[model samples]
Target: MSGAVQAKGGSRHGDPNRLGHGEVPASERGPASKRIVVSYGFWIFLLSDFVMFSGFFAAYAVLVGNTAGGPSGRELFDLPLVAAETAFLLLSSFSCGMAGIAAAARNAFWFQVAMAVTALLGAAFLALELYEFVHLIGEGAGPDRSAFLSAFFALVGCHGLHVVLGLLWLTTMMAQVWAKGFREDILRRITCSALFWHALDIIWVALFTIVYLLGSGAGA
Candidate 1:
């Protein structure tokens, strides 16, 4: 009697809507899971990036005042221009956020518009940075001039390189979205880009506060 009842219960439990322990339900095996996994993996990558930046920051801090009779940050830094660069980057981060929102809503037009604005702002920031570098080099404050100059170039140039890569990534994402219509893979890439841009914004804030504001004697 007990054996017969157990067999009947097992048969009733084998509904198509249910799955065994080792089996993956359709909902659990789809794009939702993929998105979660991609986000997790990308976050790990971002953390590693943060670690690298932290090391750069430590080195810069140690070498910031080693001017060796060369121009110091107080003499070389144009606070107003740096403020403008910060404004542009912050605004670009905002536009990037809007782009991500538009992507999530599947509004291609707004997404494109927001991304274009972001790219433009990012370009403006990079242009200003390049101008600063040119002016410094022309003033004979090249990286080879002193330990301070070398550290400054290393720290800030690394950040600038990241911005350049970010701009390229932004354009590629735009093209991918245009071509693929925000498919899960493309959307994941967009999400990762957005995260990266925001992370850069945060890093810039720290850089500006430490290297610009304090070094300029403003925060100091």
Candidate 2:
């Protein structure tokens, strides 16, 4: 009631700077545009994802040394394979960037090509990670073998699941682009997906360092 009265009184008083008096209309400075809203919302989603990963990382840190008379990371991990996975994911990030560039320039052929490259690289990374997991489980170092392995699988498997989702998103994006051309909403989605793909790269780098490099060092 008071807010409405204030607006009414302000209008009656001819206040030059008041909102209802309309030096500048409220509509002119109203809600953010769709692109701004979508981008902002997607970043909030990414931050929440990071927070979830942080919890996983902390749990892994606490349990990293709790191997129950089982093989440690150094004994179980294959660094060469992990290194290859890292290479593939990093290259996917680069290719994703190229796809974004092509999208911005509205180059259909290059965008499709770059997106395909990104998808292939991302799939290759996932393949290597899956093989590593299967090999470890075959070697009797499965998650149930020890607390350390449990934490490792939880953190790394969560990341792998996200990669799978990202690949599905990329496939949808390519389909959307092909069907719709460079529509504004589609471009916004492409930008958000690129950001997401790059974020996975960053997380993998940290995972590689903490779970592989430092974890192995601890075994020494």
TM-score for candidate 1: 0.85
Task: Give residue 71's error in model 1 in angstroms.
Answer: 1.4
Q: Which residues of candidate 2, in runs, are more than 4 Å off?
A: 1-28
For residues 1-220, write the lDDT of model 2, one tens digit per residue. Answer: 9999998786768766564635556677879899999989999999999999999999999999899988888887778889999999999999999999999999999999999999999999999999989999998899999999999999999999999999999989999999999999999999999999999999999999999998778747
RMSD of 2: 6.0
Q: Where does candidate 2 clash, by residue pair?
A: none
Give me candidate 2's TM-score against the actual structure: 0.88
lDDT for predicted candidate 2 compared with the true structure: 0.92
Among the numbered candidates, top TM-score falls to 2
User: Candidate 1: where are CA atoms >4 Å away?
Assistant: 1-32, 218-220
Q: Could you tell me every candidate's TM-score relative to the true structure?
A: 0.85, 0.88
